[model samples]
Target: MTDTVTLSLADLTARVETIFRRAGMNAAQTRALTSVIVAGERDACKSHGIYRIEGALRTVKAGKVNPLAEPVLDAGEGTAIVRVDAKGGFANPAFELGLPVLAARARELGLAALVINDCTHFSALWPEVEAVTAQGLSAMVMCPSYATVAPTGGNKPLLGTNPFAFGWPRADAPPYVFDFATSVAARGEIELHRRAGKPLPEGWAIDADGNPTTDPEAALEGAMLPFGGHKGAAIGTMIELLAAIMIGDLTSPEVLDYLGTTTLAPFHGELILAFDPARFAAGRPGNPLARAEVLFEAIVGQGARLPSQRRFAARKISESQGVTLTAAEIAGLDRLTAQGLDAVA
Candidate 1:
């Protein structure tokens, strides 16, 4: 038997879709979830890839998320704010339902904000960022996770990892993009390390006693530190304010309280801001897109790599050569497909 198997993206998507469908997810949930999961695999973002399937299934089985949710969009006509109520479903479909209206509002008013409420959130923000960028708009996306990180100068977990992402549209290339958690690393990375029987890197987290630790289990029981100390902590706080509080959704602490366990996916809100660069740069000295290319060239000339370059490279390879999964991963997929929700604890 082979140690690994390579499947075309379509095949992988079909398989993932089947798993979700069999797990009782409705078409909207399954399709949106599958898109983000497959995109994560295609971009080689393993933490956000198929590895997230069980958590989602568990959320559904626990009745914490509505698998049959059909997102509702409020165009917020005549305003710069668009809203989507996820109806207690996953955030992906909510974002999708609001994207077109958000783009339209941004083009008309130079900027717009899409607020996604009452949803369970997983997956990376880059997919949403890229979606906006593809519509010829710059994007900033952020959302709060379950409380798993410590605020600077604090010992206990009080803040979410709080992922934030930005994307700038480009005329002849992939958009310039960066996505990262305010924590030293994403909570999912620690979970992955634990599953793989590997210790986390130093400084990633602290033990319950507030001492630095590399043990993934201890980290899970303890608190993850903010990246860049106070700065990351501040950013995390900002996400809690804008994505959760301002959106009138549950903050990280509230989310954790509501779910009662970190084992399930987070139920919160998301903030996506879209900007039409051309509109913002109207009557400027040079074309905004052209100026951006020049800036990119200068940055590359300095030998500093741009963010998401590696992901885009991996995506190119996956598009042409297909995605490869280890035998163990394939077996896991088989088990999930066969057992559906029973595949998870």
Candidate 2:
């Protein structure tokens, strides 16, 4: 629990893998889950951080996730979609595996799209965006899950925050990474605050009966409002149709049969699109990321930084200082691991 407990990232992952296997996950599952979780902690996306250790173990135990499903790729012509076979709720591996398929297709066509059905949310979209950004491509990621909110003007819990994220490659700066959940707040974030026994921040959520409340427990029963009001709701709805129905066969046929399924797991339906900006703007590619940072720095009278810039730095810091796990989260991890180890033993 000490902040000074310096476990090499590789060593910590190895231990996580071994513990999972001892708890009944196969090697493939171990690799898939650990790789994603470690990346979250190392990248300092604390919300998606090691805190997920317990929830994942629960999904694995409740038969909500497959611990050994591997990816199988299929290709015919213009595009390729990878079926994650996450088994249940394990999606990080599928996301990792699906990247290259989309990247390769992008390399061939300059514009490529991939739909990842049936994988878990796996925390943040940054990890996936960073990979594509590193390859000099711009990416858009959209995903849907169980209903977590009513449409902005309504309260019915009929839609998920259904996150949408965008990343643009930069020549002189960190990737122009922008990620935000469509809801007022991410469910994982709400859960984190709940676990910490903290009150929900104002405007983040409403009670189950549609009344606004800052009580974490009530917020869980209620819905997270959309960010841009109707605008945010509209975007989430558009993404739902695109991510869930189009690729899901629930809407557009052109994208339907592209993946053969509409949903993946209990709450996961994801769509990712990537393009070489050269397709949009010819000569003199603009450095929007750099320019934005400069303008913001001038306004705030501080040094410049961008979205993924902080994460890039945090990743390095982790290499030097090691990942930090709050004592409470570590305890949660220990408890979750003990249950899994007992379940199959």
Candidate 3:
């Protein structure tokens, strides 16, 4: 069995931030990226935790991603929509720069959308949605990337994993958060399994010959099946259009084409929407959060655990007990600290 070690949340954040800075990221960029990494770990999301550090360093060293990118926002045509240019950097800073603007616009006009272009998204989508929800607005965020998932009737990959996240405000509890990928499994999960020499579940993927396989390596080499067959495929298609065509950004196929000749971060596009419930529920008896609390209570009374409830619970435990990390991850961090990007540091 693989050995595991634990670290406090504060130590984890400092270590990650130091590594990012050593990789040449500016303070703001480092903080943004580190926050996501720590949040992933806190939520017990192994796919998005420190395992991503090696890939991140590789992308920066190869000049595939700009470590010190400065994102900018442009409100297009009206205040209801805004576009953020991530400048070939990771998605965190771009989302950070655009969220407040989008939240403000939603508060004013009742609804607003933010289109993020040319960014590398390598984490869970829930954080962005949660940020918007914390502002007392409902939110939705989706993004398309390099093709990795096959459509319902075919075996070849034709779409990105295509994550979608939604959040609703609640009065006496944390926001209701739901985030999922259209594929049977996220690409990061497959990568993690492959690294650990583990087998995937049935129906998670098909081999190169379009045959099902439990081998994580084969699954990665071939195509991931959609989560719910045609239904997931349809949602993936809609996300592709909204995140790419609607934003006048490159589609999944286009992103794959760019990746064909370079070891670069696939600059993907993200689409986000924030809604002010007050606009719709104004003068209707109770506010959105109060009504949502009642609904949540009824749902919980029925013994239903809402989406992201497990994650929130995990975060509390992680804070108290510290996060567990594999021996390999600790070694990798040490190598980065000692070597300092001498290769893919």
lDDT per residue as tens, model 2, 1-345: 254355678876876776677777776667877887788788787656666666566556656566666644444355444444344445566667677777777777778877766555566676677678878788998776567667876766767667788887766656778787788887767888999999988888888788778888998777788887889889888977988787652222222223222232343557778886655454565754555556656844765545566777888888887876666665656665566645331
In terms of TM-score, which candidate is strongest?
1
Q: For candidate 3, what is the total of clashing residue pairs?
A: 0
Candidate 1, poorest ten consecutive residues by summed lDDT? 180-189
- Residue 33's lDDT within candidate 3 is 88
What's the lDDT of the predicted structure labeled candidate 3?
0.84
Runs of candidate 2 exceeding 4 Å displacement: 1-4, 80-89, 171-174, 188-199, 249-266, 282-305, 324-345
* Steric collisions counted per model: 0, 6, 0
Q: After superposition on all CA atoms, how large is the RMSD of candidate 1?
A: 1.6
Return the TM-score for each candidate structure: 0.95, 0.80, 0.90
The segments of candidate 3 whose C-alpha lies over 4 angstroms from its true place after superposition are 1-6, 188-200, 209-218, 261-265, 320-328, 343-345
Query: Of the pair 1 and 3, which is ahead by lDDT?
Result: 1
Evaluated at residue 207, the lDDT of candidate 1 is 89
Candidate 1 lDDT over 1-345, as tens digits, reads 779999999999999999999999999999999999999999998978999999999999999999999999999998999999999999999999999999999999999999999999978899999999999999999999889899988889989989999999998899999999899997768998999999999989998988899999999999999999999999999999999999999999899999999989999999999999989999878988999899999999999999999999999999999999999999999999999999888
Off by over 4 Å in 1: 191-202, 214-217
**Candidate 2 vs candidate 3: which has greater lDDT?**
3
